[model samples]
Target: MLRQAQHERVHEGFAVEAVDLVKEFGETRAVDGVSLAVPSGSIFGLLGPNGAGKTTTLRILLGIIDPSSGTRRVLGHERPLEAAREVGYLPEERGLYPSMHARDAIAFVGALRGLPLREGRRRADELLEEHGLGEWARRPIRNLSKGMAQTVQLLGTIIHGPRLIVLDEPFSGLDAINQARLEELIRRQAREGATIIFSTHVIAHAERLCERIAIIAQGRVAFEGSVDEARGRLRPIVRLRTRSQDGSWRSAIPAAARLHNGEWVFELPEGGPEPLLKALIDGEAGIETLAIERPGLHDAFVAIAGDAAAEAMGHQEPSE
Candidate 1:
């Protein structure tokens, strides 16, 4: 609900809107009629498995590659190239030169993005120091671990404080502490009025980090919405793990999909969770450990994505 509301607010406010976007490399269609609305100053996640057209979409959005067909509006402008300078992109599968120092590597990246050499190094030193990597200032990138390299890459992306931040798998190789730090950074950036597009395969992290997510699978969006709405799509499954009355309590399993182990698990039909809870109590089974285990975004993702992949192989169109 918040994501949709944010989407509506952004549609009225921001200039970055992707409409029916399509991309192809040779004969293979990587992105198929994908449409997404990313509002400025919000954290939008583009999530999917490998080869789901996520990186390709970001590349197209960045003007690194042109879309086969479709349109994107950034800051009320149609030129993605001009709009690109307004963006900061941290790619997923890229590497720094092995011999370069961490700070130098980052400074070089910033320079390529139009930042002056002196200013780029200045910002790089501040960011590295801020992240407790002051000691790693002169350390070679080859000597740094994967997590440290990831931090350096992240710093490079934001040294210029671009209006929009596009991060591909920003959480990869990051420990819990760094992940939390990255989350904080994202929130801070959003508060500063910068739109952020974060791409990752880690669903739970995305669930916690993003206000809106466009889940792509097999070159298409499987589900696109807020976490709450994604969970709302699933039926409420009540797990009653109480002291079973001689296991005979399963006889009152609503005359449907019976009990799972000691807990009665069944999909909530109509109405909502209240009806299901009331029914469990009315079935003469005392609910000592009553909990409505709402299916997470993972369930929604698997269900939606699996269906989408099946449909794609079947030569069918995207399903709801």
Candidate 2:
């Protein structure tokens, strides 16, 4: 019994854990039985389409809003905000004061989290210089471009050096270059022992950064696991291009094969590539190209969450 309890604790050792969370506003249910266990010191992603309850779930986890049902623990405290001093949150809405200077803006936000003003200002200057905003430290936010303003706000969010950083749609309006920079920053924070939880409808960013992910659709979790686990749920795909596409080679094609741009493509059958190769050789298919490829996170998302949800992520703005 002691061994079993120890194993459970190891499995349940999470930076944030929510169980059967639900929220309703008026006649609409914003979240439905949502649950997640975000691993400590890991870059975890909450993924979904717009209006999919991702923001609501994050709010509940941060104690910004109460769930109608269920419970949660943040940083081992039964109450989510009990650990607020150790958490940093950047909401989807940008709220940097246009008239505030960049350095002062960071210092102000940090102060709200119990950081001393003098130290906040010092850290703000160092952070700005490190992130390539040194020359603009004194510029007012209103004078900065969209990307610059966004980066400054992100820096403010982390200025207090929280152990867990929660970001809601952090990449929503960033250009490609800025997005890349943000990705690097998130990774660096994780390396320094901070846990990062970010929500995004865009899958590519999560694919690049997160060690584990939860896919939400219509306010429900469709799947949650490591990237490798998600991809492993799909069979490898094979593409073949033969010298001829005649009736003689029909026997060589798998039952699931489909023709695309004059090439035959299909998910690998249960028996594996050896059987397929033998079939092609015996049939004299005269293959010009035979390629077997692993599926990616996008493919896994489509398979788990359906076309509509996948399309929402796939069509996310380049800025995202």
Candidate 3:
């Protein structure tokens, strides 16, 4: 038991790592030179547009398919199949037997992942009850609502207590309330020492849940860093609201200040905040509220990838 538990810890500690990953599907290059790592107890986010190689990259990591080039390790095992028992994966394309009850569907997946049928059934019951689906456990999956079915699918994925969970577009059918519930569930899993890597196009989920994220565009890695680190790269623009009578502030305002909606929108002088604040105190602008208009990860994504995201989906925007 000790050896097995220790091995599980080791596998969870360095749950996933990849280097120079590339994959080609005949005529098209699906993934190109991507590298990333998901450390234990952290929620790592994979972000990209529809054809940006996110699915191919995840397929390689999960061992569903091998990369054309590069290397990856999961659960401390070089072989994906060998590590399968310790990893739970929720694929973007969901599959559940429509005629099968929710409990049976979950137990089936659990058994396939190496859990004893009895233990798996016990867990399925517990989870169904916990997720407020106890009343529907015996109902066929085809009878459940789409969101409820998705919730059940996720619960099944983790029923066996896998050390690392990889979720692909997990919020697809979930409503806002259930989405928040899933995010909290992810946080709880991280607190319990499980590493999670989830793919999503939603920036808010990535911002709220991920400690670190890797942005992929055009089948390649555009950026990889912590959420705060990503925010630090952009020029911090602060909008200061002030009035003419405020002689107490003058020198500290940026030279590019413009009055809009009763607020002065200007880039926080690259010189730094201390000097900016010092100057504000001496400026004639009656400073009301000092608000930093930060370019969040979403903004960075747009800046780095241009309109490829929207364009890929066949949408056009008005000229700037």
In lDDT terms, which candidate is top? 2
Arranged by lDDT, best first: 2, 3, 1
For model 2 the TM-score comes to 0.92
User: If ranked by TM-score, best first, what sequence of candidates would result?
Assistant: 2, 3, 1
| Candidate 3 overall lDDT versus native | 0.80
- Candidate 1 structure quality by residue, lDDT tens digits, 72-140: 877667777786656778888868898999999888988887878787888888889988898998999
What range of 10 consecutive residues in model 1 has the weakest lDDT sum? 1-10
Put down candidate 3 lDDT per residue, 134-253, tens digits, no spaces.
Answer: 999999999999988988888888887888889998887677788888998888777766788998877778889999988888889888988887777778878777657446465566
Predicted candidate 2 versus true structure: per-residue lDDT over 1-320, tens digit per residue:
00112112222269998999999998899999998999988999998889889999999999999999989999888888788877889999999999999999999998988888898888889999998999999999999999999999999888888878999999988888999999999998887777899999888888999999999999898998999999999999999998866755576567778999978899888899898888887778888999999999999999999999877776774643
Candidate 1, residue 92: Cα displacement in angstroms equals: 1.8
Backbone clashes in model 2, listed as residue pairs: none
Q: Which run of 10 residues does model 2 get worst, by summed lDDT?
A: 1-10
Better of 1 and 2 by TM-score: 2
Q: Could you tell me how far off, in angstroms, the CA of residue 160 lies in candidate 2 after the best superposition?
A: 1.5
Q: Which stretches of candidate 3 lie over 4 Å from their true place?
A: 1-13, 245-252, 255-258, 310-320
Q: What is the lDDT of candidate 2?
A: 0.87
